[model samples]
Target: MSDSSTAAEQTYRVVRNDEEQFSIWWAGRALPDGWYPEGTEGSRDECLARIAEVWTDMRPLSLRRRMEEATAG
Candidate 1:
């Protein structure tokens, strides 16, 4: 369960088009809603970090609760 659940909770990624249009995907599935960065003026790493921050903000409470349960289990 740990191994498989960890696999399921792995990081998701955002892919952008040449036009800056993009979509979100998680665990091989497309996220229902699309997303785009709202700020500018940074290095590539900074941009990626911002994306990560957004991802964390959108993380599911179900995942967090499951992780806590896994740890407690």
Candidate 2:
């Protein structure tokens, strides 16, 4: 989808196996549309990497303090 906040309905929920491995998906929620890796399944690293990339691309946090402290006196 568009580069915007992650809505519950548009985020790709990473479901991990009992052993904490990337197993299943709860897509269309934790991510926007068309955000995924090609032929990358059962790969924890890849899944997390994609998640981080997507989250960062969305500016997940609003750290105003960190954003202005250096410039603010």
Candidate 3:
């Protein structure tokens, strides 16, 4: 296979953080400081679909926490 095709075929995985944010990460690369793998590794499209299905709420964890605190206080 050609070098360009090989590069284009890189794999990815779905990742999420404490704030409930989602992102796609390269399959073999080290995850960043706060992010961790949320689901199986696959093509970028597959990971994005998984995030869309589960990440129904768009707010980050901090925002959700503040909203809850305001409502309670």
Q: Which candidate achieves the best TM-score against the true structure?
A: 3
Q: How well does candidate 3 match the true structure, expressed as C-alpha RMSD?
A: 2.2
Name the lDDT value of residue 7 in candidate 3.
52
Pairs that collide in candidate 1 are: none
Best by lDDT: 3
- For candidate 2, the 10 contiguous residues with the lowest summed lDDT are 15-24
Off by over 4 Å in 1: 1-37, 57-73
The TM-score, computed over Cα atoms with residue i paired to residue i, of candidate 2 is 0.24
Query: In model 3, what is the error at residue 40, expressed in angstroms?
Result: 2.3
Q: Write down the RMSD of candidate 1 (Cα, Å).
A: 14.9
Compose the digit string of candidate 1's lDDT tens values, residues 1-73. 6977764556555554333443444434444444433443244444456666654434355666778899999
Q: Taking the tens digit of each residue's C-alpha lDDT, what string does model 2 give over 1-73?
A: 6434333234334543322223336454353343443333334455567555544433223454456766887
- For candidate 3, lDDT tens digit of each residue in 1-73? 9977875687998999999999999998999999999966887678788888989999999999999999999
Better of 1 and 2 by TM-score: 1
Please report how far candidate 2 places residue 27 from its true position, in Å: 10
Each candidate's lDDT (Cα)? Answer: 0.51, 0.42, 0.88
For residue 1, model 2's alpha carbon misses the true position, in angstroms, by 40
TM-scores of the candidates are 0.27, 0.24, 0.82
Q: Which stretches of candidate 3 lie over 4 Å from their true place?
A: 1-8
